[model samples]
Target: MLAPPLAAGELERPLVGQSEAVILSLCTRGNRLPHLMCCISIDEIDSLAPRRDEDSSEGKVAKISVLLSVLEGIKDVPNLMFFSATNRLHMMDEAFLRRMSGKFFVGRPSSEARKRILDKARNALNPKILKKLVVATTNFSGAALR
Candidate 1:
């Protein structure tokens, strides 16, 4: 899971948890079928603001090039299904984002969706209280709901 920091102007490295590394290693080693599946969860992509440096453009470009090379190496291995989830789609790098061409944008739920979701959650609550809680969480995301 790539839990990018929520604060603006915070430059932090992407966090790759242990489980993610193990899965990637398995796929790279040919122990697991590379074409089967790969999953990534990235939260708050919009918060990944680039570092501000007048003379660092070349450095940033070089770093991006290195990352691209690594991605290319992975792509050469057929059968991997890369799944990435991000709330801030607009914050991604154009070049890197392009690789995920057929992207799906899942935004905040509408009032109707909230109603349906409340109906589903109602099973665990008293009917009167469920409606109140759902109404309070008007713009909550699915993750927040969970």
Candidate 2:
């Protein structure tokens, strides 16, 4: 599941209607460049790593096993790097956390940071309007501000 999208973009690109085998060979072997893998909105990871007692299906177990196997056997795939994001982290399963090499918590921005963003946006308003925008956008991300 995680591996497919890594090559999806490359394969989807219009390379004069190249075959999947040719594209895979080019991405995995033709060049020496590293493959950048990313998976966003990873909130459903618990379903992927469901507990044995929690109505886990055979298909889920198989997928989880394959994902873990791929993650564990990183050496087999040359220069493979992965990243993921999630908004609902409290619901995450402990077993999945153990497999992660690192984790980062990007919380809400500070007042000063918000002000700087507003400044970059060049909002030609007085203090009151600026303050309102900043305070109202408590949990808003930088991208959302634009």
Best by lDDT: 2
lDDT string, candidate 1, 1-146, tens digits: 23432332232334534333433443354325544544333344333323324564554544444334334554244544344555556656666566554788678887667767777765677767776777888889765665
lDDT of every model, 2 decimals: 0.50, 0.53
TM-score of 1: 0.50
Q: How far is candidate 1 from the true structure (C-alpha RMSD, Å)?
A: 7.0
C-alpha-based local distance difference test score of model 2: 0.53
Please list the Cα RMSD from the true structure of every candidate, rounded to 1 decimal place: 7.0, 7.9
Best by TM-score: 2
